[model samples]
Target: MFEWPWKDIARECELYLGPAGFSAVQVSPPHEHIVWEKHPWWERYQVASYKIESRSGNEAEFADMVKRCRRAGVDIYADAVINHMTGIPGGTAVGGTSFTHYDYPGIYDFNDFHHCGRNGNDDIVNYKDLYELQNCELVDLADLATETSKVQNTIAAYLNHLLDLGVAGFRIDAAKHIPAKDLKAIMSQLKRSAYVYQEVIYDPAGPISYADYTPIGDVTAYDYAHRLGAAIKDKKMDGLLHIGENFPASNDSIVFVTNHDLERTGDPYILKYSSEDQKLYRLAQIFMLAWPFGYPQVYTGYDFTNYDDGPPLNEQLRTLPVLSSQNQCTAPFTCEHRLPEVAAMVDFRNQTDGSFVVNNFWSNNTDQLAFSRGQKGFVAINFSGNQLPKEFQTGLPAGKYCNIVGASYNPNTHSCPNMIEVNAQGKANVVIQAYSAMVLLNRTTASQKKKAL
Candidate 1:
């Protein structure tokens, strides 16, 4: 979730993008946080109270954004940061909520935290070491002992309040830091009201497996991002064919190229560490969106020279507004989510919902990748700096259909660079540009006719 003034930006999103097919807008934490004079935006993750009084907006404004977004057929998913609280010095939250090092009268005092000196330093590592992760400080942020009934109820109340306000789900932050059982308890309390997506950065060598958090909710597939990033850089389209084959088909995973923490820490996967690397990063994102794997999240970021630099904000310490025009963003704001290729994939994914990826996959072993989605949608990618001319099975009922990638008619005509038409024989002679992707929609499906009716 990108943190901005929701009251102002949410409406624009609802009007322009929401109804077009966006199911939800993942909002940053609505909870109160510790405001720092030097880095006020750091408070976004350093939660103080569950009260809805932060930079995004007040409780009323939040409710309005929810109602408006829901009215536009868009749901809201909140980024729930329950792992720790304020760690910076002399930073009080905007809602008048305050917490000192290891001391929070409203929540829990700091001494209650664990101080195990392990990894050659005092830090939490795993569930078996629950006391340290839950109670000990996370990078100096006041950790909360979620195992306590009081803390559980407090957090539950906060989550339930959002549910009552119409939020559809949550992305649990620092989930691996908490015990699995404690997370299960918290989720059990949440019940069916909000969908939970846990953040457990996968490290196979580590004690925690994704299964630990799966019982509570969907776990993020960090490995997927790593693999996709590598394959794209290598220009190994055959490797792209292997995408999503690694994860169990039964589990729901949150797939993302870059996130708040990754972008904040200057994760090399994004920000064009090199020109070639930047193109590969964009290609990986396109591939991720095209493939039928996990619940995908698109990242919208801002330009930054330093890892610690925050979102573009005004002198008042509020985040700047987002610009909605195509290929243009507010200065310093990089709205990759609105890019033509990225936005096109959103439509392609939504249109092919409930479709499975068919197996007759093919790739040039270097720069071209092609596959069909359960006879419903077909896609081809070309990245070899040469036009791809190939005939592939589309699995569609014979009819002339507009290629969704090249010429989608929804937003407007000539909106995209390439447009191909598939004939009645379910065959397409695709000629794709070196750095582009093409997707074809099966036009004669029963669902399509039913929708037409």
Candidate 2:
């Protein structure tokens, strides 16, 4: 969640994240990388060596974190930038490894990289050219020759190192640039089968198709965020009640509202947890979590006023620790997952596992929507202004239900700090505020005294 080292994250696993019901934590790239003057986050994406040494922490610390999170029942998903090498010609890595472009000491040699610059070509100008896009350099990063046995061995060995360290999976950076067959080949050689998600940016008209990658692992549904955010931004939520409506299959997709890339790459349709859009962004998150769509990933990172700005750092280039504000998240960090409602929603998902949306209802104006996941849970969302007072089929057993979004379920009291009563007819007279949502969990009587305070 927070942009901190593995050690810092380990300390909070049991106390903060584990209790919140997080399945995994996707960390920044841990490979040794070309160190820049300011140590930008993208620089971590540029590889120097497979050594588990970088700005985040050393080998021992990384190992300790994996062990700690496992005990807490949270897996670590390391961001593996195996697509290319550093864009620079020569530089020293943050871990003290020294190397130049396409030449890492004791690893790859010059021939291991693709010299795609035919006419001194250094950039990708033809988005329509399939061969150029796959074989050529992306933003000048030296493309690896993954088809060769030597390159495949080195890549697999690197990932095996992480698997040996207890990493649960990998987020293959720039996965679209690598052929699916080559990727599958590398993964097949891992020490053990590991969960894998490829960073394949979706472009429907682009040469690369997600079909090639889904057989391997989940593909990033960038289109999900782009399209969903657009719908919510335009105050249209009725059409999105159906999960996987405009996205890849539920099991093959990984959905998110914003990530490191989208926050900086300004697109009006996409969203960031900004002052004006924070509420709306949270609504999108609710929809994602409530709906039975692809695996959902909630992003919580550094707050940046400038698109190029990296996480808060000291003069020594070390990341500053993030603190909680007792509200939704801490300052300078969009800790959306830490919000009481969001955390409760994580539990909401777990309680209603194997459930599908039923008893679906959409308002006449289409701005208000309600649905049930099986008979265990119900959710109502109001996207328009003013209070919305309407009765809808909840599909849940009748009781004094707690609004997980607005209140907390106090187990000791066996009552909600804030309660919304539902009748035996499976109806709730829900009145949600503008751009707000309510979630009801019948598995247990939710109460605000336990969490909503």
Candidate 3:
């Protein structure tokens, strides 16, 4: 969700996301931006000014949302757009502020932007050239002259202002366009330490590399999403066994199955929230959460027929609320994260956080894959259409554990209706349904719920 609607959604974080064990919520960009007629989602990325006001609501609403969500044990990560200003020649922003391609009222002047002398026009044409890609305008947007001290300070000030509002971190939007040293300089000027992740889309053959930005902060693991999506689609479990091979070190990467951009790319390798691939998408997310990987972020947003279509809007053109009826997500709002299975996997991730090493890995040489988190947790995934019934080495203690994918343990009653009993020999006879997963965690409420009779 975007615009003022996210405020109401943030209020519901306490009631829903907090108990679900989500660590943070990455809200849409809070900065003022250009006002498009149809209100395309990309408009939010084309910033007008650094002021904490936009279609997403005024500064007061943003502040209140931060405070409320923080109190619920969920940190707020703002999507900071610092690489450029409005792509439009002239327009009034959602904040009622006026701006042109090279100027934003009191903030940036024509001199503050880069009119990079590139191929014919100033726009980026050669992605293989690092210099042009860094200096040239992206999609006609006025690129920021970040090499200058004044520009670095300006960017830092915007981030510092967000930190002052109790914002826990930032998703550095379009970070690949900005030079790594410039980003390091800007990040160094922050008044306080903040969690930072740069969006450096991985391109193996590209001149710019994600490794260049990892020294400053975690970089988005695009390769993970790309490879995992392909593996799932092809039903090749072996490809994912060493998924992080060429990617950044696990600690320096922020991984996800899909994000706002990749989901809209219409790329076959990238999975999106849709009726056709819903089951497979959820299964992939379950595998990502269960497997030890980079900090995994789950994406949940609205459905769109057209790539440029924005979130559902009101008569005022502001975004409409992502409401629910009878505990089911309403139209236009997919709310994929709130799905029972995805929510259960969140708990699976939470319970097995520190157990990073993948132990006792097993597969049927194909679609059926199973692994354990050093005895802390175990998972079995069946991507094939046929049911997977097998006696395998579970690597868990003898106990009756809840199959969290289907049903969760009721700690209050110390019972789990859907239980799988592991024998004393650290083995179990289990069956996993087609295109589904089964997760069991040791040293958890489910493990202690009851003993195997």
Candidate 4:
């Protein structure tokens, strides 16, 4: 639910994403920030105050949304923007709070922020210098002195407030710019344990490394996206056999196909959410969900022509409702998670949670690939232009399983619109169409339902 307002996210969790088997959602930064006239999306990342108010919602609305979403079995992981303050020198925040450089009223003062006098303007100009990168400003944003006790306490208090409101975790934004020691100090100040994942974009040449943060919590494995995007674009499915290699440990990585940033970059290395590349992008998501890799997250955000353009906003610049009419996500909202194929695969991932071993792996040496999750589930992807018609070892118990990706399966009614039959030898001869996928789950194994021809 990228860039979705708090209230809309709450409604969708109870109505759709929760029932659809989604575990958690990474939401936009809940902290107050500069309310630029243009209302660009990146403005949300530039924090003004610790108060939980923004284009998303006010404090009361955010609290209620968190409570409702948690009750629906969906946890809320807020994107905590503790790395820096407002990029602008002085401005009124979204909550109407006034603040100037290093002088947030009742929050931070001049001494609280870092004045790393390295570059002429104290801005981060050298990525190779770890000290300047950590202490200096990022894109003219006021860098917090996270190492000091006062600053760490203030940051911890803000996070503790969210935790009190039932937040499940935090996505430490700009984590690469903050020293690992400073982050650990802030985490220690928290009253209780919460899931923490850092945004340490993998950079082998840089002074700081993803490994530095792995000891603290899971780090984003951006290389996975780079490798995956390039492979999919090249129609080289076989190369993905070693997808997670040379990255963070599987248990300590958070992975996704395309996030808000990558989707807007127009980067050919990874697929974006667009009409022209929707098929391949969807196919890549299917593979990511099925394959045993890092903890997977399905990104669903609004479509934007300009990178700076924010989500659909009302006259007041507040985010509009996600869906348009008839509960269907229309223009501006890509709603990738709501897609039947992606939703079914969420169930696929959940059902095959413990089946980490990737067995019965088969590939056409080109664009077609099939693999099984230790008899729990099997997925076959056909990326080529031609329909892939062949028999493959599925490694599931012999039975008629529903093709959950293409159709629906009602367990109570024992109805599956589309079915794939497996013989006693645990193999199914299936024809997967071009740019489509076939997913079979043990839970979807239908015995009483009449088999499809």
| Backbone collisions counted per model | 5, 8, 2, 0
Which residue pairs come into collision in candidate 3? 3-55, 3-56
User: Which sections of candidate 1 miss by over 4 Å?
Assistant: 117-121, 125-135, 245-251, 264-279, 324-328, 407-425, 446-453
Residue 224 error, candidate 4, Å: 1.4
lDDT (tens digit, per residue) of candidate 3 on 156-185? 999999999999889898899999999999
Model 1: residue 39 alpha-carbon error in angstroms: 1.9
Q: lDDT values of the candidates?
A: 0.68, 0.77, 0.80, 0.83
Q: Give the clash total for candidate 3.
A: 2
After superposition of all CA atoms, the RMSD between model 2 and the true structure is 3.7
| Rank list by lDDT | 4, 3, 2, 1
RMSD values for the candidates in order, in angstroms, are 3.9, 3.7, 3.7, 4.0
Best candidate, lDDT-wise? 4
lDDT of 2 by residue, 149-169 (tens): 899999999999999999999
TM-score, every prediction: 0.88, 0.93, 0.95, 0.95
Tens-digit per-residue lDDT, 1-453, candidate 1: 477677655655665556446567778888887666555346688877788887777898888888888887777888898877666654466778766766666666654445555654455555455456555566766666777777677777778888988788888888888788877788778746677888887665656777777877887877677677656667676776666764644246777777766656544434342234555566666677768777787776566666566666667666766654542356576666666666666766776766745645888787778888876777777766788888877766565555555534454542334445566777777667777776766544513110000
User: In model 1, where is the ten-residue run with the lowest total lDDT?
Assistant: 444-453
Q: What TM-score does prediction 3 earn?
A: 0.95
Model 2 score (lDDT): 0.77
